[model samples]
Target: MVAERKTHPYLSLMNSYLIDSPQPSSISYWYNLGSLLGLCLVIQICSGLFLAMHYCSDITLAFDSVEHIMRDVNYGWLIRYLHATGASFFFVCIYLHIGKAIYYGSYRKPRTLVWVIGVIILIATMATGFLGYCLVYGQMSHWGATVITNLFSAIPWVGNDIVQFIWGGFSVSNPTIHRFFAFHFVLPFILAALVVLHFLALHTHGSSNPLGITGNIDRIAFHPYFSFKDLITVFFLVLIICLFVFFSPNTLGHPNNYIPGNPMVTPASIVPEWYFLPFYAILRSIPNKLGGVVGMFSALLILLFLPLLDRSLYRGLAFKPLSKFFFWLFVFNFILLGNIGHLHVEVPFINLGIYCTIAYFSYFLIIVPTISTLENILFYLGRSNK
Candidate 1:
């Protein structure tokens, strides 16, 4: 008789999930981004924990404490740089991961929950990032926090109340920083839990491949093959991140964020982090305060409808010529929106922002569905002709 297994429960779990789990052999380097994202999260969390130990959340001390971390604490500069740069890197991986999903039609039936969970993770990440940026207590941080919180005042009845609740006072003050810091510290744990749920849902449907084919014969164990591939990708990503962290640490951050916050004075131009620029452009594109807020949020919420909106029978963009073209157009429009977002709200920039916003929504509300329908019709006609 074969010897009875005597492995620990934890080891058994790891074996089943990591070592024994099967994935599509056709999966390319793009798939490795999932692992890279996880690595980024781990780095952010670890660095954040260390930074939090010495961080002072008070309005008076927050800025000085950050400077203290950089100048006085041993390797605190490195840790701080890692955490700061890691946020940008995290979003980079997530956008690529989401793009890979869209390209492969990973949001289709049976995997809708996985895609929804991923979107939720994205929202959570955005919230956490925004809150963390506020903790810096710089000119931009103070005004940005004030500006964002003030947007809540556009609500009808309880708008002012909600703003007060968020600020924990009349305006962005000591309590504001404290609360934001608390939430910023706690939100990552919540994000970690959501990521676990996302993985569970993804595993239920298995991973979608580049060709959007799902066949057991084409699958292989996640370990040794994909694991090695992921390892190599992670190594390269780490090298890139290290370059940013050590050499060009402040390249992604704003210079205004270095100056201490002064509620009495506002920066000449207040801008958000680069990752937020697309939605920020949408927000500023509108003339009305409430309307701008609504448009900005709608831009993000629109992504949730992707599974239903994309009514195509074909799985990947490779099979849909029209959609492939428009998909790239949508990406180009997004970059344009970001660029316009950074420009002064001048006549030409505002007009450009408006047009880009229209294109952005049209891609989802009109272009995708129409293309999918046309493709389906042509497919049916070709079969009938045959």
Candidate 2:
């Protein structure tokens, strides 16, 4: 039975995935965010597939079917809430993952493509999340879509055409709901593909650890060491998710969505899902509809160019004194934008939105480039690199 050839060791290269490499440093909790993102993707997909079994994409019966699953199917509520809450958790993980990248300089040099893929994932997730919100066919979902799609009209020349074509008609209706659901169901797979691209880039450059030292060969393998660490975080994550599913399933949800879609009634406030509040604020900051939309999309588009924005010789947060301050300030500004996004788009809120939107872009356009320049000057002056 043993007919193995002497030159056949490389034939089982796939087996190497399970073995640990010695390239990674002693990573901590921050390292878990990327793997946790992968876990969330799986949870979201499974929960969604189950819910899809009972979901009726038809606008007329969509709300009724969701109600039926709640009232009739055994433990359907648990599954539905898990899927819903998984979404919020998913974005939180990505935010932390993105921050981890920034803090440790994972976006520099060889890992820039990884960062690029992450941004693409971020945008795609937002697009699908927006569509997913509309799939519920509730009053809030309807009006939320109305407010969001109207933003496309900000495009100047062909904005109106883009908006109408996307909706499959002049307004949000059955066609809109159906298309949203189809896209919602489809986007996560595309996200998974991007994730594959991301990991390939990560593997090619090797993972950037806390020290932000990527070129060192004296590190640990990803198989046993990193995978074991990630598995521990996965358990804790599930515990948190289960708490939301079993206890406060409705906590993150708007009460208005409980009611079925009603054209005669409009919700007092048109807010998006909580995860999208920051960009939602950016969108509403402008007085003009098309302008608001452009601002929102452009804000994200700017992130794709970050490798050029920052030109510092050093990458980690600890060494760059000036860059460190601006980084934290920008983080706070982002959080503030999210808080303001939940408020009514009036007076003080609009004013705050305008400032935050400007500040938001400035962090990339000005603060980042300025700090990087300051670092280079300091470096040339022999200020400090140690």
**Which candidate number maximizes TM-score?**
1
* Residue-level lDDT tens digits of model 1 in 1-386: 11222266666666757877888888889988889999999999999999999999989999999999999999999999999999999999998888888888888887999999999999999999999999999889999999988999999899999999999889899999999999999999999999999988888868887786664678898888988999999999999999999999999999999999999988888899999999999999999999999999999888899999998886878677788899889888999998987789999999999999999999999998999999999999999999
Candidate 1 weakest lDDT stretch, 10 residues: 1-10
- Tens-digit lDDT track of model 2 for 184-276: 999999999999898777767677767655548567666667778888999999999888888888888889999888978988887788888
Error of 2 at 318 (Å): 2.1
lDDT of 2: 0.83
Each candidate's TM vs. the true structure? 0.97, 0.93
Number of colliding residue pairs in model 2: 11
| True-vs-predicted CA distance for residue 263, candidate 1, Å | 0.8
Off by over 4 Å in 1: 1-8
Model 2 segments beyond 4 Å from truth?
A: 1-14, 215-217, 383-386
